[model samples]
Target: MKELIISSINDNLNNAVALLDAIDSKTYSDDSIGPYYSSIGSHIRHTLDFFDCIISGIDTNDIDLTARKRDEILSTNKEAAKSHIHTLQGTLLSYIDANTDYLIHVTDNMGQGKVTVNYTLESILAHANSHAIHHYATIGYILNQLGIDLKIPGFGYNPTTPVNKREGI
Candidate 1:
């Protein structure tokens, strides 16, 4: 189960990079599909930061402070954002894989003892996958609307698609 979870995360992380590579960064900004709701870069970065920061006991305040598309620092720093996302993705997944035992230890931060139990590594894996896919699919739709072919390595219209099942359409 641990191995499966780790593999799934790595695949999703790679898919993120593929989609990032396919985007025309200049055109994906305040007026883009997700915009204030969730920019592609911000979505990827936030997912990466959430996993990395939460596990490392680092502050996630910075991500929360990031406002709308017009206020995004990553909009002009596409390369840096991609690099940050890649680095965080690798670190968090590796950390989780190495510490699979933590899956059973509930780190409940929810208020009033209303905390939910810790996610199994598999559940956490699914969370991360869903996070990235949700945002990436939005990006795909936006690009398509702009008549831009993403040409992604492993992504399809369907969100749950595995990399192996996709052939760069």
Candidate 2:
């Protein structure tokens, strides 16, 4: 189970790296995408920040989802974003054999107010993976609007999603 979870998260992170490699700083930082007006770089940074939170709180056993870095450089510079992602990848690799099923306290706001709840490290990692994919889908939309192709197969789709239903499939 640990291996499976790690592999899945690695795949998503790799997908993000591939995307960063393909696009330039201009496209990455472009926030003119309409509606939400969020940029690819912003989405990428936000996704990574989730994992950063996990890494930050894992040692102390108190994961706070709200404690995001939200660094502007990460959301405006492609190279910085790539560097951050690589750092996170290295950190995750170091935890491959760690006790993922161990209980941890997670704090996040569902709607009303901030609340702390018990959750396994594995569960939090899984949730972060799914959260990354959700943001990837949004990034995919931004890429399409910018007339750019990810060129990476299944870049923004969940594994359980039907292949036939995937965009550009």
Candidate 3:
């Protein structure tokens, strides 16, 4: 189970890297799009920050989701974002055989109030994986607006998405 989870995370991060590799800085940082006005780089950086929070809290067993370092460079420079992704991938790989039974204290404020909840490492990792996929879907939308192709299979779709739909059925 641990190996499977780790592999899934690594695969997702690789997909993110592929998307970044396929676009230039102008496409990545452009936020002139309608509705949300958010860039693909912002989404990717946000996704990476969640994982970073998890990894940083592993030792202390206290993860603060709201206290993320929203680095502007990460949202502007593709090379820097890729480097951060590789760092996260290495960190996750190192935890493959480690204990996940310990509780992780996750703190977040969902517009109502700040809430601190307890979760196992495995659970938070699962959440982070789903979160990254959600962001990737948004990034895909942005990519489409910018006229760039991800060129990576299943770059944004959830795993349970029907194959026909994923193939544009």
The candidate scoring highest on lDDT is: 2
In order, the Cα lDDT scores of the candidates are 0.55, 0.88, 0.86
Error of 1 at 110 (Å): 10
> By the TM-score metric, which is better: model 1 or model 3?
3
Each prediction's total of clashing residue pairs, residues at least 3 apart in sequence or on different chains, is 0, 0, 0
Model 2 C-alpha lDDT per residue in residues 42-70, reported as the tens digit of each score: 99989989999999999999999999989
Q: What tens digits encode model 3's per-residue C-alpha lDDT throughout 1-169?
A: 7788889999999988877777788998999877899998899889988998888777987899988999989999999999999988888999888977767799989899989999987789889999999998888888788776556787788889987667410
lDDT of model 1 at residue 74?
A: 55
Candidate 1 segments whose C-alpha is farther than 4 A from its true place? 34-38, 57-71, 102-115, 156-169
**Cα misplacement distance, residue 74 of candidate 2 (Å):** 0.8
RMSD in angstroms between candidate 1 and the native structure over all alpha carbons: 5.7
Model 1 agreement with the true structure over 1-169: per-residue lDDT tens digits: 7666667667777776666676667654525554445455665555565455344432221221122233255544567667866676666556553544544433444455434354555565566566666666666666666677657655533445665665543
Provide TM-scores for the models: 0.64, 0.95, 0.95
